[model samples]
Target: MNLDELDAALRREFTGAEAERRVVVRQAGDLADTEKAETDRGVPLTVDEIVDNLSDAPDEGVASRWNWWMGALEAAYGGYEPFQVRRIPKE
Candidate 1:
């Protein structure tokens, strides 16, 4: 889907902190962590899933990239995956 469609989907699917977190993170490369976002379009996981992966990931850099949990989300997610929500819009 295009950026607008993705935004609508995100808006419909999430709100508040959850939605905000998705907006902050910038994904790139591949979502090797989870299948939530795996599809013809790209990763489809929610903000919660992303945060979980980040927390579980062996690397800490992923969580250190941004002012995580600033507002939209309230937890950590691994460094942005290429197929992540934030990255898809730019594509």
Candidate 2:
């Protein structure tokens, strides 16, 4: 999904400052890139897939949900740890 779609999907699940939401979208784009490279099946993770993955996340915030998703990816595939959203700047 494009940034706009990603942003909208994120909006449905997460409530946060606009600034924070922007950062999450940017980071999600980076994760998309990483998924493109990591996947051997040639199908990158779609926006729907991402939202579904985050749906079961144990945390409430956007950043936490993102980190949780990336954490799962990291466990299944090494090298995804770097893509985890470590810090979301305060708005």
Top of the candidates by lDDT: 2
lDDT of 1 by residue, 1-91 (tens): 2334433443444333433434434331123243433442264556544454444434324323222322122223443333434331322
What shift in Å separates residue 7 of candidate 2 from its native position after superposition? 0.5
Candidate 1: regions farther than 4 A off: 1-24, 28-36, 40-43, 63-91
Q: Score residue 22 of candidate 2 by CA lDDT.
A: 81
Q: What is the lDDT for 85 in model 1?
A: 42
Which digits, one per residue and each the tens of the lDDT, describe model 2 over residues 27-68?
777867766434733656777777887888986877778788
Pairs clashing in candidate 2? none
Supply the global lDDT for candidate 1. 0.37
